[model samples]
Target: MKVCSVSVDLDPISCYYGIHGLGEPPAPLAHVVLQRALPRFAEIFQRRGIHATFFVVGSDLASDPSGRATLTDLAKSGHELGNHTHHHRYDFARLSAEEIEREVADAHQVIAQAQGSPPIGFRAPGYDMSARVLRVLESQGYQYDSSLFSSWPYYFAKAGVMGVMSLLGRRSHSVLGDPRALTAPVDPYRPGSGPFRRGQSSLVELPIAVSPFLRLPVIGNWLLVAPARVRTRLLESVRSRSFFNLELHGADLLDADQDGIPTQLISKQHDLRIPLKDKQRAFEAMLDRIAQDYRFAPLREVATDVQREGKLRAGGQNL
Candidate 1:
C-alpha cells in the first residue's frame, strides 16, 4: 500500500528565534511549543486515528517535565518518538564528529528514557544531514533518517531568506546545507557513504515530500499558507509517489493571539500569523484528501516495511 507518514518536528520556540537571528526567547516561552502546541497535534491525530512520528529535541524533554509527560503519553498511544538531536543547532551538519555524536547520543538517551526504548528514527536539526552525521547514526544503529530535504525551491528560498537576513546584519542560525542535496533522490533510499548519494549503509534516508519535476515542498507550513488551488496542485503533483513524508512543526498549530505568541515571533513566523483554527482546518483537510490515496503510518513502521520487503536499493529504486 502507498504510505503517507506524517511526522512532526517538536522544535522549541528558541529554534525559531535562532532561525530569524532573534536572540533567546523569554523564559516562559521556552516550553511553549511542547506545553501549548503539542496537545493540539495529539488531538488532531487522535481524532483521525493516525499514529504519527514525533521528532524531539532532547534538551526540551530533559529540561521540562511537561514535555516528557506529553511524549510519554504519545508513545503509549502508539506514536513513534524519534530523535531530533539534543540542542537543535542549525549548524549541526558542520559540527565536529564528536559534537555530532554527542548531540545524537544525548538525544537518544533521553528519548529512550521517556519512551521506554531507543528511538529508531532520527532527523537532524534544520534538515541538515552530513556524512559525519550519518556516521553517528550508523554507530547508534538508527533505522532511518528523515532530514534530507531535496527540494531546490525550498533550498533557494532558504538561501534567499538567510542572505537577506545577513545583508540586514541579522545572522540567522539557519544553514544552506550541501547544494548536492538538492539532487538527492526524492524517495526512500539507504544512504551510501555521503550525504546525498545512494549507499550501502543500513540507514534509510527518507527525503521530505517534494513534487516530481519542480521539486517544491509539500509540507505543512507551505500547505497551510498556500492558496487552496495551489495547495491542491502541489498535493496532486506528489500523488503518484509511493511514500509521502509529510513533515510539520509544532508551530504549525500555534495561534498568535490565542497561544499568546509575542508580536516579535508572530511577525517573523509566517505560519504563526495565521489563526490556529485556520491551520487546524487546513491540516485536517489535507489529511482527509491524502487518506483517499494513501494509508497513514508512522515513519518507523514505513522504514521497517521497506527493510523487510527489501524493495529499496542503493539507487532508491524498487527492485
Candidate 2:
C-alpha cells in the first residue's frame, strides 16, 4: 500500500523570528498562526479527508487562552497534535541532555494537558537532533521521531540560504544540523543507539520525504516556492516510495500582506511572498494529487503501520 503522512510544524512567529535572526516580530504575528491560520488548515484537511499531524510548540499553549482553545479544537476535530518541544529551540543540538529532557518534558506536559493525552511523536526544531535527544524521547515513551531530513539537495540549499544571510549581514538564528544526516536512511528506521545509525532504542524515525532520484525535497516550504514543473516531478517521484512523509508549517499558508506580518521579516520567507490565493490553489492541488494516489494518514498512524511492516519483514514476510 502507498501510505502518506502529512504534518505541520505549528511554530509561532517567534520561531520564524529565530530563523530570520530578527529580534522579534510584531505581536500580531504570534497569534495569527495559531488563532488565524490553524482553523483554515484544519478546514482544508477536513474537506480533503486528510488527517494531518500538527507538531505544536508546547510553550505556545502556556498562557494564551485563544491559542490553547484553537489547539484544543483541533484535537476535538480529530487532528493528531504532536510535540515540537517547549521553546522551539534552534540550537537544540547544542543543549545539554538535561535541558533537552526538560524541553521535551515541559512540552509533553503542556500538550497532554490540552489534548488530554501525551503526544507519541516528536519533530525536533530546525530538523536538528542528536543521540541524546533521541534518548530523551525514548525515556519519555514517545513512539517515533520525524526530525531526520537526509536529502543532500535540501542540506546544500539550507546551507546556501544561511550562508547568503550571513554575507548579507542578516545572521539567521537557524543552525545547520549534523552533516551526517545527509547520509542517514531516507525511510523509517529505529533510532535506539543513534539518530544516524540504526539501533535498538525502540523509537522509530520517519524521515521527511525526498525524491529518490535527486533528493529534491517534498516539504511544504519547498513546494510552495518550487516551480510547477519541479513540484509535479518531485511529487511523482516521492509517490513511488512506500511512505510519503510530507512536512509543512503553519507559515506556509499565511500571506505577507493580509497577515500583518512585518514586510522585512516575511520577505525573507520565499513561500509567504506568494499571493495567499495562489498558495491555496497550489496547496489544494498538491493535496488532491496525493489523495488520488495515496491514502493520507497522520504520522502517528503511518509510523505504526511502518512499524508493523518492519516486524513482518523481520519475520520473513515479503513486503
Candidate 3:
C-alpha cells in the first residue's frame, strides 16, 4: 500500500527572522505561529478526517501556555507529536554530540508531558541531520528520523539566498549543512554511520518528498506558492514513491495582513502575502488529489511499518 505521511514543523516566527537576517522579531510575534496558524491546521485536517504528525519545538511548549493547550488538544484529537529539538537551531547539525543529545532529550521531555506519550520519531531543525544527530536519536530509542532532504534544487536555492545575504552584509543564522546530503536516497532507508548513506542502523530516515528526475521539492513552501496546474503536475510526478513524506510549516497557514506580520518579514516571505484562505484551498486540493492513490498516516505509524518490513523497494529492487 502507498503511504503519505503529513508532518508540520511548528517553528515560531522568530526562526524566520533569523533566516532573513532580521535579528529578533517583535516580542508579540513569538507565539504567532502556534496561536494563529496552528488552529488553522487543526481545522483543515479535522475537516478531512486526517491524522498528521506535528513536530514541536520544546521551547515553544515550555514558554507558551496557550500554544501548549492547543498542541495537547490536537494530541487528544488523535494527531501524533514528534520532537523538533528544543531551540530550533538551524546550526543543529554542527553542534557537539553532547549538545545534540541535550536538544533532543529536552524536546522529548516536553512533548511527552504535553501528549502524555514519548515521541518515537524526530525531524531535525532545517532538515539538517548528521551522524551525531542520528546517534542521539538511536541512543534515545527513536524509531525514525525524517530529516534528510535530498533535493539539489532546494539545497542550491538555499545556498544562493544565503550567499546573496552575505554579500549584502546581512548575516543569516541558517547554516548550509554537508553537501553530501543532497545525494542521499529520496526514499526511506536505514542510514549508515553517516546519515546520508544506506546501512543497517536501527533508525530509519524518511526523506521529504521530491520529484523524480529534477528533484524539485514537493513541500508546502513551494506547492503553496505554485500555480494550481503546476501543483497538480508536481503531485502527479511524485505518485510513484511508495512513501510520500509531505512536510509543511506553520507559516504556510499564516497571512501577513490578517495576522499583523510586519512588512520586513512579508517582503522576504512572499508566501505570507498569499491569503491564508488561498493557501488552505490549494493544500486541501493537493490532499484530495493524493487521497485517491495513497493512504494517509502519521510518520510514526509509517516508521513502524517500515521497521517491521525490514526491506524497502527503491528502484524495483529491495534495499
* Model 3 per-residue lDDT tens digits across residues 190-306: 898999999988888888999998999999989988888898899999988788889999889998888899999999988998988889888888888889988788988878777
Model 2, span 1-319: residue lDDT tens: 5777899999988878788788887775677788777877888998987788999888888867898988888887778989999998899877999999999999999999888788999999989989889889999999989999888887888899999989989878899999988888888887657899777777788889988857778899898889999889888887656678899999888877887778777667767789889988998999998878778778888667656666322222122
Candidate whose lDDT is highest = 3
Give lDDT for model 2: 0.84
Error of model 2, residue 319, in angstroms? 10
Worst 10 residues of 1 by lDDT: 310-319
Off by over 4 Å in 1: 312-319
- Pairs clashing in candidate 1? 192-199
Per-residue lDDT of model 1, residues 1-319, tens digit only: 5788999999999999999988999997899889999999999899999999999999998999988999999999899999999999989999999999999999999999999989999998878888999999999899889998888888999989988998999989888888888888888887789969887888888889999988998998999889999999999998878788999999888888876888998889888888888889988899999999888899998788677775532222462
What C-alpha lDDT do the candidate models reach, one value each? 0.89, 0.84, 0.90
lDDT of 1 at 7: 96
**Candidate 2 residue pairs in clash (backbone atoms < 3 Å):** 192-201
